[model samples]
Target chain A: MRRLIVGLCWVVIPWYLLSLFVGSRVLPFPHAVAIRFAELAPSVLLRHAAASVLRVLAALLAASAVAVPLGLAMGRIPAFDRLLAPAAYLLYPVPKIALLPILLLVLGTGDVSRVGLLGLVLVFQLLLAVRDGARAVDAHYLLSLDSLGATRTDHLRYCVWPLVLPRLLTAMRIGGATALAVLFFAETFFTRYGLGYFIMDSWMKLAYLDMYAGIVAMSLVGFVMFVTIDRVEQHVGRWQG
Target chain B: MPGVTDRVIACRDCAAGYAGRDVFTGVTLGVAGAETIAIVGPSGCGKSTLLLTLAGLHRSSRGTVLVDGTPLESGDPRIGLVLQQYGLFPWFTVLRNATLGLAIRAKRSGRRFDAAGAADIARALLEQLGLGGKESDYPRRLSGGEQQRLALCRTLLLEPEVLLLDEPFSALDALTREELQDLLLTVLAERRVAAVLVTHSIDEAVYLGDRVGILAQNPGTAAGEPARLLLEANPAGRRGVGRTDPLHHQACAWMRRRFAEAVRA
Candidate 1:
């Protein structure tokens, strides 16, 4: 709590000083922006935040649900790894944001397109993370487990999943940040009900303070998502630390 | 207990290798119940491979490994292995690792895994192994000796009929190694499990085994030859005897001479 307070002071004081020097509508004062944020209807901001959160959550859930199992299979089984490794190497490097136009065209600019694009970006990140993590497990550990008469399912449950989870969470955190950034860009294109739309709309209307307020709200979303993942990681990987 | 028999473990002309290249072959050995056969060989002599084959973790390319007169199979719970590196799962706490075998047995038998019962067994084993207060600690937190004891505890909890150990005390300091060796002998005395210990140290082989087998490096043309039973001495009589005793020194001297000659040839 003390660190958070100190960090806020550092950010707020610097912004306030900069705003004072500028004294222009382009960079409104911090106090004015805060006041404008307070004046806005809570429901309006809440709805935008909720919509953005929903899209990100949906994308993350879908991506992990598919990627983790496939990644584990690829990591453990030589046949699956041999088949998928080449494709993973080929597709992992392509900038996923470039697919936005194609996704919008195919999915018709709906929430489906937005969710699909974000999920596509996150799937590769998570799959490769899990694959590498699983591959990194020491072979001796598996042999020991095998000698104990652990079945195939037991090996997966006791050895593979728990060992891979920490790496998976790390990948999820990075993927979450990337998803938010891409969400902001995707929101700028179509529809009217997201933080990106609200901020861009306020900027076009020359309401600089409202735009700053929208930016603050979106930053809160990112902060909350990251903190949640960090907490989950700590809880799951307590043995690590 | 159904498959338990008087014959503990017997290997008849077993051969093991990887990728079409043989590491060792034509190895015939038998270990009676409660007997310890120490294998001392030069590096790359396939000592570890023979132990793995006996434990059923590696397949014999030719011939057979019989555990209680039954052909050995991989993942046989009747045989337990203690790797040289002490292959304890880092993700599990010491207590959890020690109880893993018991839990698996319960699940295999379609019985409810009584967590409290398993914990009691694990706690007793840990206490006996001198790891009483370290149950919740991960393997990484324990010292090398403690980690070794924990690995032994994990395997012994299952009451295996055969124990295959690969240089189980090679990594420890001199003092810790001796202490662990004594502890292992004590445990084996009580459990009466057949054991095959692989080591590079002539003293360790002489100190631990009822009979010491010497494996020659058959790297190229001599791949299918069996290891010769180099020495059969009653080392168990010197259990409480000091290492510096005249008998111990004589045995060590004799083993050193024989081991050097075997490796050179």
Candidate 2:
């Protein structure tokens, strides 16, 4: 709690100074934004924030479901890695948000297109991280397991999966940030829902207070998610220390 | 004890090396039930390779490894190997590491595993090994001796007829090393399992081995030829011997002198 207050002081003071220096309505004082954020938070921003959070949650699940098994396969099996790595390398770095127009046209501005874009942002990060994790399992551990007459499935369950978990959680935290960036771009396109659309709409109308409220809501929601992932990591990866 | 009863694990004329080069050649040893044959040698003598062959972790390039008269295959359930570093899985708690061997066996055999029963068995084994009340702790939290004990527990849980250790105690301090050596003897006596231990310490070999094998280079052989391992009986009969036993000291001194001569030759 003390650390949080000290950290807030670092950011809040800098921003207050910046606002005072700018002397423009564009970047309002910290007090104005905070008051406005309090007013709009409960009724107006909550619904949009919920929509964005749900989309991100769905993307996280879908990306993990598709990537984890495939990443593990690539890591553990050389032949599988040889076959899949070429295609993954080609597609991983292409800007996913660039496909927003096509996605909106095909999926018709629904939640599906937005979620798909966010999924694209997160999947590669997770896949590469998990694959590297799997490949790096100590040969000694495998030898130990094999001495017990382990089947291949047992090797995966007893050795590879547990070793890969810490790396996977770290990748999730990194991927979460990229997914949010893509989420803003996706929601700006064809939706009335989501914090992204709310913030952009407020900015267009010169309602700076509403814009700041939407940004704060989105930051809080993302913080909640990142905190949740951190908590899970602490629970499962305690043995790392 | 090593040669009196029928051999539980036998390696005949075994030669092991990687990439078509022979590390050790013409190695032969037979371990009877409740007997421990310890191998001591200079580094790179292929002592570990010899142990690996017996455990079926490595193939004998020019010979055969037989477990109870059956040819050895990789991942043989009848053989359990403890590595040099005590290879306990850091990700697992103490209890989980102890029971993983049984769990792996059950999974492979397609039997219905009773997790509760396995846990009970592991709890008893950990308690016996002086790891009581530490079942929930990760391996990293344990001391080196404790980690070695955990590795021993993991291997022992599989209930193998034969145990192979590769320099299992070389990393410990002198006192911890001696204590673990005693604990190991008690475990082996209680279990009556055939064991082959590879070590650098002549004292450790003389203290634990029913017969101590000296492994060294074949100085007179040609460039392509590998090293040799030869076994000799130990009169100390390690069951009750300790640091104060004059007989153990004599055997260790004699073995050390012989070890120097063998490696030099």
Candidate 3:
């Protein structure tokens, strides 16, 4: 399949070079860099990969946890929207990367700071999307259900939820992608064991092939995550004509 | 059709509009078990507001609307209002949209919806509206005509005693408009429910309404503008009495005269 071809081109071939060429430095290609990769080993690579993924996932999950409820609250209550919306808009445009010094000062040089930075960036976009999407739901549909003697819970489940969910899923797709990209940069700047960190560390040691290998790994991870989310969207939206 | 004993709705002095401003005042109307009524008016004359008030979407500024002698309330299960916007939930499939009313009511009643029964009714109604085989599609994927049909089906599945239609077909092309108008006429005639429709087109007014009214705009003051019912005319009854046929010419003439009178008043 096309996916198989892509996997081979991106993951298998690059990883092969990483293992064979970068693993065993035989010439001007440098045994030092290969020795570095080998010393790290498969377990270290995996641990770093897992750590990086977990950090990104944690940031995304935390952002969504806060954003969904905040968005719904804003959409349902006009007073809350008026009170909260201006502050979010004002904060959203400030580049999240620029806040690293502040985050480091507050949280110390740890995963907490990295995750917090990425989450701060992601939540603003997610909140806006959720608030606007939920607000756009038709008043008539809600009123119709309400008039039908539907309880508040019934209205939320049957009418409001259905009306707003597709929009939320779409927002999640966009927010998740943005958060992943931000996570990469965050790792490059402030982590010891991620694809971002690996690339930066290898590049500093003049290991161009290993740096390329790290870049390839991070890209593959991002692509896989995006595709998985896209699949979820399709499955959930299947009933829609 | 149900017997005379099954008279389901009545509106007595059911004058309603917006708060602090009147649309139609001292307006009384009624629907027998299987009767249909339609209200027609010029642009911005408050016909839609009246329909909303009657359906319990808005509270009456002046009087009361009753269902089988019980006062109407917001979210009354026996009433449905279809605005020109179609208001189809963009996230829902055609089948889901159509069955939403039943689902909401059932959940409130401590019973879940009978999906098979709801699906059957929705399918039949969608078929009648020419939306067959498109049940799994979303509103965004549907044509304007198709979305309107889905809205109609959604309203019909609950078997509302009163249906309020606010220019439901005006958004479509001429051909589609006529086609939908005819479909609605056929459906309403068969269902025999009371309907109050606000329309701009005189041809549509004559074609769809059993009884039609031309409403006037209240002269604006330092306060907000109010709306007044200029005349409550029964086109069908007039035709039935051999006074005048509800033809295009007659309807147009009536509209022109009514418009001139409203302006003069």
The C-alpha stretches of model 3 lying farther than 4 A from their native spots are: A1-44, A89-113, A136-193, A200-208, A230-241, B1-7, B12-19, B140-143, B173-175, B217-225, B230-263
Candidate 3 lDDT tens digits, A1-241: 5985776677555655666764544222324444545655476666667777898789878988998889888987899999999999899999988898899899988999999988897889888888887788677767655555567666566666665666766776777777767777777765688877877787799876677556556666777777877787777676563
The candidate 1 chain A region of ten consecutive residues with least summed lDDT is A1-10
**Candidates by TM-score, descending order:** 2, 1, 3
Query: Please, what are the lDDT tens digits per residue for candidate 3 over residues B165-238?
Result: 87899899998887788788778778978777778776676666666666655444323345555444554343
lDDT per residue as tens, model 1, A1-241: 6745786688789888887788747788777877887777386778888899999999999999988999999888879999998998899889989999999999998999999989998999999998888888778878888878888788788898898898899999999999999999888888898888898999999888889989888888988888888899998888877
After superposition of all CA atoms, the RMSD between model 3 and the true structure is 5.9
The share of true interface contacts that also appear in candidate 3 amounts to 0.65
Chain B TM for prediction 3? 0.84
Q: List the residue pairs that clash in candidate 1.
A: none
Which is the winner by DockQ between candidate 1 and candidate 2? 2
Best by TM-score: 2
lDDT value, residue A234 of candidate 1: 91
TM-scores, each model vs. reference: 0.92, 0.93, 0.77
Could you tell me the TM-score of chain A in candidate 1?
0.94
Q: State the displacement of the C-alpha of residue B131, model 3, in Å, after optimal TM-score superposition.
A: 2.6
Q: What share of the true interface contacts does each candidate keep?
A: 0.74, 0.87, 0.65
